[model samples]
Target: MTDVIEREIKIKLDIDPSQLVRNLEKEGFEYLGEEEQEDVYLNGTVKDFRDTDEALRIRVVNDKVELTYKSPKMGKDSKSREEITVNLDNKESMIKILEKLGYKSSYVLRKRRISFRKGNFTVCVDNVEGLGNFIEIEGIDVKESDLVSFFQDFKGKFHLNGEPITKSYLELMVNKLDNSNPN
Candidate 1:
């Protein structure tokens, strides 16, 4: 099982992100962000053709995109996952790509995200359609000094102090996309 702990943070944005990312790179960090294309999902709905045991996702980077599938896992804190990602640009080709690789393509998306960490302080840039661009921070097993340092650095870059989130967007979607109630 993967052991790295995850944290969630959000920051408001006002400036051009391209220039923002370039500035971050010069400050001894790398930009990490991806776009996600999500297949329609609904809770307690019957589907013979789709797999619910996995959350299918697509991630886009600067040079290329990636196809990934994460197995559903239950944990004390929440469900965790193990993922496998491959470089590809277009998500529509995944079914054929997976067939060629002798794997299954259950779902696909076009997602863009940028994230990085300095020590235990982590930051993310996410762009999801209808949601817009967002900045997130994950303070994983961090020390007080590291937290203070990031608070200053990140606060200086963007207006922040947004709270953490426990539910993922899919979880939100399931409730929002509901067509019928489960008994």
Candidate 2:
């Protein structure tokens, strides 16, 4: 079992990831290779996660499966929250267990992620199958007071001109699908 506080920022990018990779390399961030990740989001039996701002997900990355629960963001500036994660031995069994417990599958997100590491922060440039490209900076064990400044410095270093995205990828995908299909 692993429990930690997650402080992060997501920026929607208009530029290509290869370009971003070169830029990050120039700034001395080490390339940490890439991986394909599949995330299955689950809805609670009695509570609507959308309304509660919480998430329960099973993420498969590099043949390993992890069960993660994220609480709602606590403060205003950055997406800082408590994250509890556990490793699962069997993906199929875990899925079946969640299903039996009335946790319905909300959505599945597939993405190709390129990762970089600099100091205590890990940066992921994600190419989501349906939602396009985004850059996310995540720092574990970060102080609450430094959340906003950490994001600001990262944004400045990356020369990210777009506004920071507040919504999660699941929310973005849900909104996109909703907009595409007329009521």
lDDT of 2 by residue, 24-130 (tens): 99989999999999999999788888899999999999889999999987756667789999999887899899889888888999999999998888899999999
RMSD of each: 7.0, 1.5
Tens digit of lDDT per residue, candidate 1, span 1-183? 233333343544555666656666777765544444444222222332234555555554444656555555432332344555556667557655545655454322233567766566656666655445556555644443455456567766654444434445554444544644565
* lDDT of all predictions: 0.50, 0.87
lDDT of prediction 2 = 0.87
Candidate 2 runs further than 4 Å off: none
Top-TM-score candidate index? 2
TM-score of each: 0.47, 0.93
Clashing pairs in 2: none
Query: How displaced is residue 132 in candidate 2, in Å?
Result: 0.6
